[model samples]
Target: MTRPLLDVRDLRVTFHIRREGDLPWTQPRELHAVGGVDFSLAPGETLGVVGESGCGKSTLARALIGLVPAEGQAEWIDGKDLIGLSPRQMMKYRNDIQMVFQDPLASLNPRMTVGQIIAEPLTTHHPGLKRAEVKERVKAMMEKVGLLPNQINRYPHEFSGGQCQRIGIARALIVEPKLIICDEPVSALDVSIQAQVINLLIRLQRELGLALIFIAHDLSVVKHISDRVMVLYLGRVMEIASSDDLYAAPQHPYTQALLSAVPVPDPAHDMAASVVPLAGDLPSPLAPPSGCVFRTRCPRATERCAAEVPVLSGAGHQTACHFPGPLTEAEIAFARRTEAA
Candidate 1:
């Protein structure tokens, strides 16, 4: 087996929430944002994480990069645990791990010029370089991401949504990091523009040999770029498998329901007509439903599913489902017969 370049084990993150009319001395309840998630990524591979909003997809990305406080083991490059590192210790790890946040406008500093923003990492990590070298490096990064070198002097608000995201990418890539945590990088852009940014990311990944943890709510977007895809619900992992296998024959009920909702391109077979609608709002992370978090929304859920949380098992494909089965030939035939009738 190819050894994973980055490995996350039982990663968990929680936030404290105060109860109503509670005294300041009272201990706040812990809201589990990420609960015992595990996955690994090899070099030059993209691991896509997909789920609905509030599913902790974004939180998992932030946790890996140490942007948010978290607990659990994160081993990268040299078997070092990132979660246990101090701020000073984490500073050394910064150049190896970078993040491109969801909103470029919000992520980028308004006062700083694009060149300044992109060069900030170098200044912090490689301050020995001369000012001239920094300017050259910043301009080169802009050009690499299909931006005009002349615009290196421009501010964040001066660029278009797509351009801003490109600048964000340039900044993330300027450090030449080993892995990038992209949290919905293009979800805020126009559909046409999303393709451009995704293409840019793919091209850069190929050229630079970078590993990526791409987090998004849209499975179609993830399907376009991911090598492996993992489905998340609430704060827990539901399934993890190769992109092709997961899409072709999803092992989990949640994964099937999500794929069923994807709009089919062929107008003759409208997916909306055949797709199953997911019911109920996603339960609050503060008080997630007992056992399987998805039991309330799953169609194949049973009493056992509600009584115990299924562990992720299997050799190649992993799923947290008590009753795991593919759509058998018999089931497919029956469905086709019903459609014919």
Candidate 2:
């Protein structure tokens, strides 16, 4: 087995918020953004994180990079625990881990030219390099990510959504990080552009042997770029399995519903037949249900689900649910009817 580059165990991120209430001083509520996510990534491997919005996908990414305060262990193979590191302390690992944000243009500074933006990381991490060296490396990275050297002087607004994303990719790669966290990097672009950026990342990953944590709500996109897929819901991991296994046979109710919602490409395919209907909206993380966080909306949820929290367990493919497997025909029918009513 290739040694894992990053091993994350029981990682959690919580936030305290105070909302207006009848009392003079309302007690702050704890919002569990990430309740305990565990996974590992080997060099050159890609881990796809899929869930609905607000399911802690971005939070988990931010936690790993130390953008948010996180608890539990995120041990880098090189003997450093990533959790609870100060910004100054994290500077040591900045070159090893990088992030590509969701909005490309927004993530880049409009005032800076493309060259300046891409070269910023190099300057920060390798300040001793000569000016000529920085410019040469920046131009090389620009070409690597499908950008023309002539466009280096152009501002972000001068480029298209996809091109801006290319610039972000160039910026992240210039540092030559071992792992890159892509938080929905292609979500804001057109379908064609999404494909282009995703393909670019795939090619870059292959060529550079970089590990990636691709977070996206698009299951089809995730399936295309990921070796393993992890399903999260209400700050908890619902299921984790190899990309082929998870899509072919998802065991958790939440995972089933998420995959069922993915649009089928075949026009003749029966969409309704494949869907595992889920009733009710996602519960508030501030007051997540007592046992299982997903029970409030899960069709297979029972007294056992509400009475006991399911620990993520299993050998290769893991699921955190009292009853894990494909939804039964009866259960599917009942869920569909319940949604209709």
For all candidates, the clash counts are: 0, 0
At residue 247, candidate 1 shows an lDDT of 90
lDDT agreement of model 2 with the native: 0.93
Q: Using alpha carbons, what is the TM-score of model 2?
A: 0.97
Residue 319, model 1: Cα distance from true site in angstroms: 0.7
In terms of lDDT, the poorest run of 10 residues in model 1 is 330-339
| Per-model TM-score versus the true fold | 0.94, 0.97
Each prediction's Cα lDDT score? 0.88, 0.93
Highest TM-score model number: 2
Question: Which stretches in model 2 have alpha-carbon errors above 4 Å?
Answer: 20-26
Candidate 2's residue-wise lDDT over 1-341, tens digit each? 87689999999999988776636577677999999899988888999999999999999999999989999999997878989888888898988999999999999999999999999999999999999999999999999999999888899999999999999999999999999999999999999999999999999999999999999999999999999999999889999999999999999988988899999999999998888778888888988998999888888778988899999999889999889988888989988998888
Q: What is the clash count of model 1?
A: 0
Reference-based TM-score, model 1: 0.94
